[model samples]
Target chain A: MTITKKEVVHVADLARLDLEGEAIDRFAGQIDTVLAYVDVLKGADTQGVSPTSHVISLFNAFREDEVGTHLEREAALANAPDKDDENFVVPRIVG
Target chain B: MKLHQLTLYEAHERLKKKDISSLELTEAVLDRIDALDGEIGAFITVDRASALAAARAADDRIASGSPAMAGLTGIPIAVKDLICTKGVRTTCASKILENFVPPYDAAVIEKMKAQDAVIVGKTNMDEFAMGSSTEYSAFKPVRNPWDLSRIPGGSSGGSAAAVAADMCIAALGSDTGGSIRQPASHCGVVGLKPTYGRVSRYGLVAFASSLDQIGPIAKDVRDCALLMNAIAGHDPRDSTSAPRETPDYTAALKDDLSGLRVGIPREYTEQEGLHSDVSKAVAAAVATIEALGAEAVTVSLPHTRYVVAAYYVIAPSEASSNLARYDGVRYGFRNASGTDLLAMYRNTRSEGFGPEVQRRIIIGAYCLSAGYYEAYYGKASQVRTRIREDFETALEACDVILSPVAPTPAFPIGEKVDDPLTMYLSDIFTLSANLAGIPGMSVPCGFSQEGLPIGLQIMGRHFDEKTLLRVAYGFQNATDFHTSKPKR
Candidate 1:
């Protein structure tokens, strides 16, 4: 499970992160070391074991489908870096 | 003495008795922060005007009627920056969110406000709560109060140091792995990580959803309990919050350990690189508990060795997904130089995130990627089951498990910053409790030869924080370690 530079670039693409030059080399080296350590799980005895995704078993947690207090448009957009009057403005989505 | 030095319970009693005004207490704490925070680097932001204004309002209520005074009325509490504060800047100690003020308070912050607590400020933390040491904070490294050159264990280092230095009475900190407990141990304070879902996570900037829990860092065990009383409960905003009845956590603070069964996990002590001082202190603390009439027995958590691996895989996988929301569109920093939407995402993320955050994201995406998901994230989840079962089996024979919070006490600030794997291993003894969804706490046990503090960790079954608090309270009542202050 050695992490290669091309693999780093591929994963970075999927994650929408740009790692170029020395960062790519550094991340490849560091992630490779980490992956090697995590590979120890391959030897574990997990036969017929269901993965415990959530520690405490939770049932369907729901509330009545009624109108609830919600954040205002201004409040919701408080932290937005680029916001138009009513919506978050991102880079052009379509050419 | 400065009012900041008073414990939460003591301040509450005095506030109720009308001996000290909330404004006076708030001023004392603010003055202390003004004097000490520059050297300690504990607080990222201190909202003085708002704190004093809140304190005055608390005083008005206290003067109005007997029942008007809540337990935390006028008490200045520091909050970790990761927890959102309405109108107050909530930086997860990352440059990307440095000026990002939230429009709403976190659930825990709402709870504190309901009790009339004055939030002194937001404290520093490792960016996105990723690192074991606060060195990963983009702003500055939080220095340990005990020794300024050393680190305050993180990612709750700033909160721990503020409490240790008496800048605030008690602070709220989140523990994903060992964020709260490890730093509390290093700073010689009480830190508690309640059972997963014990505290609501609404507006807590998500790190690892399954593992994240917000708890109290206090001057002693009793204050931790008092703070817990104010903050722990169910919240509809956070779906994972357990729908269990909230108990008076302070009622569990009986100074006795008789008839309690304490289990010592052999795997913890036998682990290599466990500092001799930390091991000896834990062993001695167990002996003290045994003398207090609790029976001690050996219990095995055989899956202990695999915890670090499992945690690294699971936490980051979740983090990678959780952090996707911060893509520079709806919130925080944005680099708008890209020509297209996809390029915008890449360039924004590249410029906004720090090195450790980038590293974890890359690692997480790799683990959850289609081809590798089964071998990594899937297998890691099954190993998680084994770890949980190990705790369940051990708890069947014991009331609580006693262990060291971390392998070693706080190291020098820059010691492990370069080696990510070694830093990850520092959380070896702590990650299992999170994986098992149990409550764990740290109380000051002993001091290393260099005068750094060591923490004794007590872990109990899910929803059984009472037992953990009782045992820690019993131990603190018999020791003076928690009262020792670091010289400025």
Candidate 2:
């Protein structure tokens, strides 16, 4: 399954990566090589066994209800790349 | 002593004995990082003033003869960038999180502080633990101490690189698939991915919530065991945290390999795609175990092959959903502005995520979307069930399973950069553990032709991490592959 340049473009569009020129070429080349190696899946004998979700055999590892202190608004919003009063500021989304 | 050179155990012992103050240990590591970090790019935030303050408190605790705090007081340890450290910036190695200083400590960091472990600094990682190599890190790729040009293995690459480079004695790393184990092997150190739910995930920026787990990376099995003691156990803050009594990991480690029933999944070894060096390393590691009085037997994990495919589908699907919360208004990176809510989401995520991450998010959205859900996401879940059954049955026959951690050692930086598929394939050997949510460890086994480290993975049943540690530590004592270090 050769990942075509088109697929890279599609994936890029889907992933929202802003790319042009060299990055496009680089991602396409890199993704193709990776797909080539993972092609080993084509030869595996997956006959009757179930595909596993977790290796450990525990079920329902839920915790008990507990209350805890959360960070104050000041601390939580301190690291935002862009922020306003007690909230993150961003580009206007709609007309 | 070079600060980065001391193992966690060594540093702790010295601090406990009062031979060296925590401040001295902290200073030494800070100095070492100051001198060599320019070349390796491991630390994201060294926190000198805070680290010294923390060290001073640790020394006070030690001098006061406080039993609990003495355990980790004065030992400098690094945190993966993903783990939130209150007031310290928690960058997932992406511009989206460039300035995201978490308001609180991640659960594990809190545990570390409680035990008196001095904070060395924050190490770099793949933006949001997505990349297989540290190359995807927005800041810089952490070089393998063994070779500055090669990657240390990623997402957790900086964490492992820090340990190997002596940037810190031990570091915390999260493994969604193989992040911790793979890099540990690449850099010739110990990496462990505890069984899912073994360590609390609260405050760990979610990559794939179901598969993600936090674990320890250190110079040897003992260090990992000790660190696990501190971090493992039930935490109410994390709903998925295991409630069972955590075992004494250190107590499980001993020279006695007697009665250890080791299973070698024929499918893992027979896979046509295994690299020759990795195959050889797995085989040799088995032989050494046999010599230690452990019985090795061939077993079948029929669905082992689908682990990677299933993982890509499941992890991304979960990641796509988990990351949806990062849309600008609530938290995380934000773009300049948008006309409305929807536009804000589009613009913010467009600017926040890197290429690979965005790619996964799209694929995840598509697979989990309304029309395609049954075909892709639905089918993947069914496959996930089969994979879990395969391990369950295999474990019934044996206490532990052995395989290669990664298909190969650390590859050249740009070798697979162009091929996302090739990069994904590198995780062939490690993906299963995450998919199955079991405990997996990477133990340095041998070297590649290029003298790069190759790691052997030993997996254990869910919640039965004792066997994994027992077997891994047993292997460590039988060989000296772990003692070798890279010349910086």
Candidate 3:
């Protein structure tokens, strides 16, 4: 399966990455090669086989739904690139 | 004797007898790092002042005759850059998190702190544990201690290299598709990855959640066991942390594997690209195990070839979802050129992430996108089930499985960096263990013709790390491979 530059651009868009000229072509080629390798799975018979998402035996883990001591507001904003007293400052989303 | 030359157990014995102080040991390791780290590039951040302060405090506790003396008390340990160390910079070796100092400690870090392990530094790694070689690290590539030109098999390269060079007594590393064991093999150290959910991943920067597990890289199997004793247990904060009882791992360090059933997987040794030296070393290891009275039998994991392909799909799919949190809003790097929020997200991610990381993200986004979910992820998950069942069937016939840890020893830097597929295939032997959720370890077996180290991998059933450690300990007792240091 060959991945085109257009598909690479689309995937990058969905992934919230802005790929420029060289990166777009490089990704297109690399992704195509990787996809072709993984394409071998289609030949294997997977009928009636249950898909595994987690390797371990997992059940719904639960605990008491009570208030717990957590990171403080200041600590939460500690690594923020740009932040106000109570909120993180992002580019204005709406006019 | 140089304090940096002491293993975790050796240093602990001296500390207990009051023959040496924690301060002296910490200073020795600091001195070694100062001397040797220029060429190895093992650490991204080294907090000498804080390490000294912690060492002094440990000495005070020792002087006070405190009953809180633990196995790891005051021994200097370095953490991988991926695990969060509270108040210390925890960059995942990416330009994006170059200054990310997490406020909370990872569960493993908290355990180490409770035992007063002097955290000397955070070691370098591939950005978010994404690459097989540290060549993809945004900061600098970590070179193998044995030869400066060869790459230390990564993304645990820094941890393995540090332990090999005696920069720290031991270090913590996480394995996602051979990150820990492969590097351990190349650097001639002992690395053990416990069963999935055995160690909590509360604050490890997610690479592939199902495949990612934090383990130890140490000078010997005994030190690996000691590190395991300190780090392994249930954490309430980590929902996936196993609720099973923790065992004293060091108790399983028996020299005799008399009744152990060692299975030799037919598929592993028969792979086309396997190095002849690695194969010969592994065969010699089998002979050594047989000499110790364990029966070696042939076992088949029929779905082995499909593992690398399946893993690339599942791991990246999870990584895409996990990495979505790294936008410019809450923390980490942000681009100032974007005028709007969407553009900001794009520009920040595009500029922040390195080429390999961006490639994986794109691959993940493509697989999970609307048109091709079932053909890729769904089918891959089915193959994953097949791979897991293959292990189960093989384990039914034997107690443990043995194979070569990596296809070859450390390759030259930049050899396969440009080709992602070839690099992915380097992990063929190790990735199946992760897919199966079994405990596996890399113990130094022998060296190559040019003197690069090779490792023999021993795998055990779920939560059966004791058996794995037993086999490794037995082999190590018979050979001096683990004791041979890389001559600089």
Interface RMSD of each: 0.9, 4.2, 0.8
Q: Give me the runs in candidate 2 sitting further than 4 Å from their true place.
A: A1-68, A80-95, B1-4, B337-340
User: Which scores greater on lDDT, model 1 or model 3?
Assistant: 3
- C-alpha lDDT of candidate 2 relative to the true structure: 0.81
Docking class of 1: high
TM-score of each: 0.99, 0.91, 0.99
User: What is every candidate's alpha-carbon RMSD to the true fold?
Assistant: 1.0, 3.2, 0.8
Pairs that clash in candidate 3:
none
Q: Over 4 Å off in model 1, which ranges?
A: none
Fnat of each prediction, in sequence: 0.86, 0.46, 0.86
After the best TM-score superposition of candidate 2, give how far the Cα of residue B434 lies from its true spot, in angstroms: 0.9
CA error at residue B127 for candidate 2, angstroms: 1.4
* Residue-level error in angstroms, candidate 1, position B357: 0.7
lDDT of 2 by residue, B335-355 (tens): 656566665666777778777
| Tens-digit lDDT string for candidate 1 (B1-488) | 66888999899999989999999999999999999899889999999999999998889889987447787888999999999999999999997887798988999998888777999999999999999889999999899989999999999999999999999989999999999999999999999999999999998999999999999999999999888889999998899999999899988989888989999998887999999999999999999999888999999999998999999999999999999988888778888888888988888888888999998998898999999999999999999999999999999999999999988889997888878898998999889988889999999999988888999999999999999999998898888999899987
- TM-score attained by model 3: 0.99
Judged by DockQ cut-offs, is candidate 2 incorrect, acceptable, medium or high? acceptable
Q: B43, model 2: CA deviation in Å?
A: 1.8
Give me the TM-scores of chain B across the candidates: 0.99, 0.97, 0.99
